[model samples]
Target chain A: MSMPYWRAAGMTYVGYANACAVLVRKCMKEPFKSQTATRERVHFKLSQWLDGVPQQPIVRTSDDGGGGGGGGVGKK
Target chain B: MASGSARPGSMRLAKLLYGNVNSYLSSGAAGINGGGAVWGSTTGLSSAELAPFGARSASGQIVRNRMKSVKSIQKITKAMKMVAASKLRNIQVKAENSRGLWQPFTALLGDAPATKVDKKLIVTISSDKGLCGGINSSVVKYSRALFRLNGLDGPDKDVKYVIVGEKGKAQLQRDSKKLIGMYFGETQKSSICFTQCSMMADEIIKSNEYDAIQMVYNKFNSVVSFQPTVATMLSPQLLLGDQEVTGDLDAYEIEGSDTKEEVLQNLSEFQFACTMYNAMLENATSEMGARMSAMENSTRNASDMLDRLTLTYNRSRQASITTELIEIISGAAALEG
Candidate 1:
């Protein structure tokens, strides 16, 4: 039996839609990879900024806490 | 999936038939069709002040779009898997029960009436579009394999095909040389057509035109997966590849509805109608399931992309701020000097 002409067009449209959809995904994939790279760069920059700050001394003295030891520590 | 199978020379003829869609995708390339989502609004509090979701031109925008699109696809696939599962449950039940019925029916009748074989036809049913993974392609390949077995590639093979859905039409239309006839839009009709499908079947069966008939369709196995399978429309023996077994007689019952022979006589039609009815429901459910999964994946991807974009915007703004601050301090020190 023969089918309606419109149905053929409709089916074609579906193919058209699928074809479009698939190609779109193919196009989107490359850009997505770029986005990942950009994100990684941002993280790299942030880490650099944190590393620029000062660092604490490896060792410390107790006398520094007494403010030059103006007053006696053991005897009144 | 229109025909539940792929077309001959599909790879070679890709441009001839599906070229229109290729053009359409190109036209929409700037957006999701190309590589990016709509830039959307970059307005409001100025945290990042990126353009609107639909307005951006940067890679960030494309990233957002792609992420969203992929997530949606995953969601759709997942859902399709589930739907196929439920539909599979019902279909499998029917298939199991019908197998028993078909066994006896075929045994009694020996073989479906060959009336007057002349015309050759193959009807393949698939969705208009494709999103489900291998559901359509596998069926198409299966159909092609059958034709190959039947010597369609040989000079003597004069077979004709009538596709039942959009996907099948696409594949067939691409490979026009092999085609003898076309039937489109059977699925778009108001209902799963036993009457129409049977009419089509009757045309071939009653006329004895076609030597054999086959259907390639997605058989739901579980909620997460579906198998595209080929079922024989004529000569189940072809698909089943089994030897005919002639056994003893077992009479059927019929009070007012006529005897078992009556039903058995219509069994071919009955089976055709049942196949069409069940396939319609199952296919729809599977389609919806795939779409649902695709959409959910898109949503998640969009959110992730937005997060990354916001981070970039903030860092850029902060860098600009720090530069200004350092300049201001240096200028003041110069005045003091």
Candidate 2:
């Protein structure tokens, strides 16, 4: 299953993980949020996982030479 | 014959007294002489009598103008103090939040082998603007001290500088022009972001010049104080080298087919960017904190100046009024005589 939300928005996996770490801290509350050591450990582990993820290949589509004709021209 | 002699003697006495008073007024003792002395009998006194009052009024105008200008400056400093206080709040939060991304890496890198290399790159983080009370100078001073300690101040030293702000660049260039490598101007919004750190990292990586990179920055201690700090970014080779990792490096399993070297390289680069980002955030927070305190001091100083100027203005104004009143009362007495 493809997870669109997991895709990094114009950032490398490391950048994305760092950003997530900041967000996680920002979203947390009270004592849990204040635990910077745990948060840093999570950040380090996230970066490691992101480092292991396989990079997606680029997909390219070429235009057919049929010009203005629809599927009929290609079929003919 | 005795009566005629008495009238003449009285007239001579009055004339001598008038001459003495006129001489005293012309001497400008009270700075109340202006235009001419009021000769109640239609013959005005000489211009010398008017000079003292002219001087007094002119000085009074100067005091008034100074008071007005100082008041405006006080307003500006007060506004600046408020703005810096607000900005410090936000940046302090950001600095606190970004700590999670780099603290672990810093802990790991702390155990890395310390190898002495001749060539070093010192990244000095400072702000473009100056009104913030020794924030930039502290970093510059720390960098210079490091150069001195490492014998890097001389021409034979292989140290190079990457100055982030204009203030540090302007200062460090005086020490040695040849030591400067790259300079980044102030950000467009007068604030720093992670992208800027990433860009700086890319530039440093591309240079491939130094064996070790050290960052000199102001560490935010509190709203009123900051300290100059140094952090070192270890190279990938140095990190993965025979030096035993002190932290929990064994806990995370590397699953990729990529070689350990490639993984280490990527991780190091990411770590470098993260460290730079953290430094930038912390430095920005420090800058704002310093600025807030500096502006607070300036605002207080401006208020003090206003108090002094207002006192002088009031005193001068009252003196001028009293001088005028005395002149009018003495003139009336002279006319009555």
Candidate 3:
């Protein structure tokens, strides 16, 4: 089976789905748009551990208000 | 001399830890030999009867301390219960909505039991954080049972694992360490989304070639109950091989320039994501429900222990007060005589 346009672009399904989800979120009107934005807001802190001690954590955040929607949330 | 006194005190503490209240009270006589100053309270001290009273006050102190700790724990569990309850309400609604995303696909594809698959991938869904009752363990247990049932418990079996949370990974790593192929976590920190599910699905598909995928998760039956369930997704090759020539799927027509094989392939991949999305949402809802009930049970247990501890403390206090009163009355009688 041939790969979809997304898989052809070397993008995982998450990137494609997130792009589609952001697009849908942008097209919404009024109260829902704000609600969707609020719900979609992703913020998390990640820290690397050496030996048994935890290092300084870095906070990753995503806000699609400016239409720059896609940000990495996947951790493997 | 110091060792002699410390021995009985440690024994009393050990008894208290074991919750042997009867033996704890009976062991009061051990304090007589040490001969301390009635725990710093010399009220009506008649030299001969000092030890029992000293031990009583000490035991009372211990009981009070335990009660304080139990009360604080109850408060924490109570707060956790409220938090889980509120989270459950929000996630349950979303879970209900997500149910719609997968049903149409299942209807179109024809839900088939994967019995003849040569290779299998089992996805065990759990939460990263615990204190959510046995939901994580139950999923782990169920997955292991699946392994055992399919004769995949051997060292080299046809089945592999894709653990979706830290809790499941930790649990499965003990025995099935070699079987785990992929691990994903940090899901509990943020709310689950379709995009996240799709990402996991895509990664899982790329990880290996499996004829069948089984998702093991807890189904939220209600606020008070959850059931361990398995949802199966067959590979496109299996779907095509097992599909009947004139099945219900033939009723639908292909609209675009995409051929039948291309359409089926794309639909299968999309359906894989949808199934994962639904399973994650259900597992999340079940996690909340499990946590709420677990916290509720913990709070109840704390309250029960508190009640028993309070009673013991009050009784000890009353006994001390009665001893003082008896001493005062006897002194008065002797002086009058």
Candidate 4:
């Protein structure tokens, strides 16, 4: 009973994380960089931050857009 | 005193882990306790006894689990939509840049006019991969329908179904007997390449196995859709409404003789290759479109499933706890009686 819930939770989190990762990237992006990328990062992270950020993600990362929370987004 | 409270807690923990002993527990309740239903751990427990729990939990679990999973799924799907949108922009750019090559290419494939063009060959292009809405099936369906349209459904003379995609051939299982040749995957390795597909087309042409070479595949329209289309890959001059082949032999149509024949032959060969490239790219687009849609839908369904599951877990746990409370109260009542 709990197994399916967790699995769905894992999937939901993984999916949520995917979106959060995107949002985080935007939020993490340096404001000094391109406006669009920066705005996207900002948009992504803000919603994620508001949604109550997940403590951890099972999947390592999304490697597309040549951006996986690197450079500006990765900065604390 | 602390030990007195700790003893019941320990017993509860044991029951939670070892078995569903006290509450007339069912196997479905165990679905939460263990990794999954497949595990033997769920065995022996009577789910039948907990029919009320099942009925109640099923709905409540489905509802709450759906909501929680949704908020998460919505966020995820929204991200995927963005990702698909971005990838789509690039594919559109490439398709647009390559239009110069495809426009003239399709123009060369004159409309399916006149019944004189019999003895046809259909080169059905399909993606090597899967998870695309209905590209493979649509191609197979259209190919079968085309066969009917051609008035060439004789068992003695089977249509040479030249399959270009690994998945496509598989989908055309019903028409396996009709498949004369097959090709799989990208044009990288020597084992499965465009050279092989082209060779199949050429050999069939030289053998006079088929009079007209037609191709059916999805033309990538946009990121969201791919339209299945059939285009003529090769049209022999003699078959293009040219009645009485022997009548042209004595005619004065030999002005440039060798050059005209030479050019036409090269055009036929080059035309075949260009079509193959077009098909390969178009098929890739189809794969991408289908995968994107499938993933998006999966993301959504997962959310709904999660909602129901979580709800069940909570209700099942609550019902179990409530039963424990009732048991203690009843024991005291009996003592008073």
Candidate 5:
């Protein structure tokens, strides 16, 4: 069976759909453009657990600029 | 002899009037002390303040402190309400728009009824922070009810849970610790994007153990109401095997060169992400709405409490002043005599 473009490109359907969503958010007009841009920004705090105890967290923040896809699980 | 008799009679009458006045003053003082003692418990006044006449100042001090705290609390709730209101407005629009991404899939796939599924995965969506009224609890209760309905009487062997958000995990952990397969957190700290939902969906799909996945979330009905809703997505294998789904699939023209099974698999995965994205947005919107109403109620309560406190403070203050004036007037009359 022939593979879909995303599948051939080594990306899952979810990754393709998310990429499309990001593209759509970027191509919008002003006001909502900035709004979705701000909305798309992500902030996360990563912490490692050892033997049922949690260590200090490391905070990470990123702004997803127009289709510059970062790590899907780690950054996005 | 006549003047001596008159002076003794007058002295007896003077003593009688003074005794009556002293009793009246003491009785009035007793009433004030009683009020002070009752006020002490709520106002957190020291025992020393229960002394005669000292209660007036102490009572005023306590009322002021209470008013100050109430005013601050009111300010906080008011600010929280405003924040929730604005956030609701923002997320509500996004939630409405995101519904378009999944509604077509729902129409195409139809709902896969939960009656005969062998392995079921329930995905519950909740928030991290609380004080948002009963939204989280309602979601949890709905999931529990679902568990009960699915014949999870004792050990919950065939059923598993994929909890999204910290609140859901915290709550579901108590009863079904072993039943939880995965947990996701911090999805509500900022705006929930499609990527995050996609990532969550990917992880859930990776497990590939369940025959069907049921998503439980709070559906936004209006600014004041939300309903606990469950939407089910059948696995690709289940969809392919079902004659009704296959019949529905035949209606749509397949554009890609891939086999029908491959296309169905891709569609199923994509649909999972879409549903999850929509559900997260809807739950987030509902959470903000719940919080807005909660904060509004609290602000109103704080103001009402402040009003009652002010009335009591003013009444006691006026009473104390009147009592002092009475004492002064009685003392003046004795001196004049």
Candidate 6:
């Protein structure tokens, strides 16, 4: 795939993602658009990722024979 | 017989006086008339004795030369204005496009709590080229105000600076030589790019000298208006510091093996680059806008000067022609007599 303009322009992944997030926030409609809290939440999340925050494990499977049954333990 | 002798003697004296006057007149004494009226009535005098008419032609030549120079200057100013206008349009679009990257980042920073730091780095953005109306001065003024507000004056001042552009460096060097940590002069030589911003960020980050960084730049408001603005970018320590951790921090979930510290470091670097890039874009746009207006003013002034010069040239030319005509008519009248 061709490099994106921001990347070609030397924007880091965090920078590019942050811009996309902001653009997304701007396009949100109605109640979602008016909700500053949600927008801030998105901004916060995007910033965290942009800051290179490590991804949390989505599912932590138990190793004690209850593996499949306790797979959803780390969900937040 | 005695009366006859006396009359003859008187006539001889009269003839001698006339001969002396004729000789003087032939020697170009008519030039001393000072343009009032050439003594064209003296048959012994030549038309060359009319020095004022010749001087008028010389004066006309000087006026024509001045008008020519003004016309060339007007052409140059008009071309410069056109070039600036086109550049302004392109830069404005770029500035607008980059808004998305920085606006949200700004909002996030805005909500964060302020953490006081001892050593602050201020980055002043301006362009090397001037003749733009106070564009560089505005940033310089903003930086000065920042120093004053933070009490960053005198020997004990803890503020440091990273100045981008020769204009800002030259201005700030007068007062803040000790405070300038680094200077970037090449960015304004050509259009600024993210690579330049990255290089600047690396320098600032590698120095590991300051607690926080602030960018002072001219923000493009419109073609005719711009304002010096300050955008603060927190250092890694400040970004991850407990004091700056807001309620919004709980909304994000990190992934992978990277620790918060690593993430913060990377984030700070990325944010630094982004912020610098954004500031550069805005400053570039503002510079172009300022230049466009400045060039427009110059072009207008040049045109005004050309108009005035043309009027003077025409008037002088007409005056010379009238003088010559009067001289020729008087000379002809003298010849007829």
- Per-model root-mean-square deviation over C-alphas: 29.6, 19.5, 8.5, 20.8, 15.2, 22.4
Residue B55 lDDT, candidate 3, scale 0-100: 64
For all predicted structures, in order, the TM-scores are: 0.49, 0.67, 0.77, 0.53, 0.77, 0.66
For model 3, residues B1-337, the per-residue Cα lDDT tens digits are: 2233236778877665455434444666647544354332233223443435436566665667678888998999899999999999999998999989889876777665436566888889999887887889999998998777667444445887778877987888887877776677676566776655765676667657788888899988898788898888877776776557226557778675655655566667788888888899999999999888888888888899899999888988998999999999999999999
When only the first chain is scored, the TM-scores of the models are: 0.25, 0.34, 0.61, 0.25, 0.56, 0.40
lDDT of 5 by residue, B76-127 (tens): 9899999999999989999999989988997888876564577888889998
TM-score, predicted candidate 5 vs. hidden true structure: 0.77
Check candidate 5 and list the clashing pairs. Answer: none
Which ten residues in a row are the worst by lDDT in model 1 chain A? Answer: A40-49
Please say which candidate is ahead in DockQ: 1 or 6: 6
Task: Give each model's whole-structure lDDT.
Answer: 0.44, 0.64, 0.73, 0.51, 0.76, 0.64
lDDT measured at residue B300 in model 5 versus the true structure, 0 to 100:
82
lDDT of 4 by residue, A24-60 (tens): 5556556634543422221011000112222231121
lDDT of 2 by residue, B3-74 (tens): 322366688878877876687677655443432444321232243333444377765665666778778877
Tens digit of lDDT per residue, candidate 1, span B165-262?
Answer: 66665665565434525444534333332223333333334333455555556655554566665554443233233233212223333456443333
Clashes of each: 45, 7, 0, 17, 0, 8
Q: How does residue A36 of candidate 5 score in lDDT? A: 68
Q: For candidate 1, what is the DockQ-based docking class?
A: incorrect
Task: Please give, as one word, the docking class of candidate 3.
Answer: incorrect
Chain B alone, TM-score of each model? 0.57, 0.78, 0.81, 0.62, 0.82, 0.78
**Per-residue CA lDDT of candidate 6, range B1-337, in tens?**
2232236668887786687567666776546654334443332234443445536565556556677776887687678778888988887887888778777766665523233567787888888776677889889998888877667344454777677777887898787766676666656543554544554565456554677787899888998888788887776676676444444455677676655665565666677777888888899888888777777777777778778878887887888789889999999999999
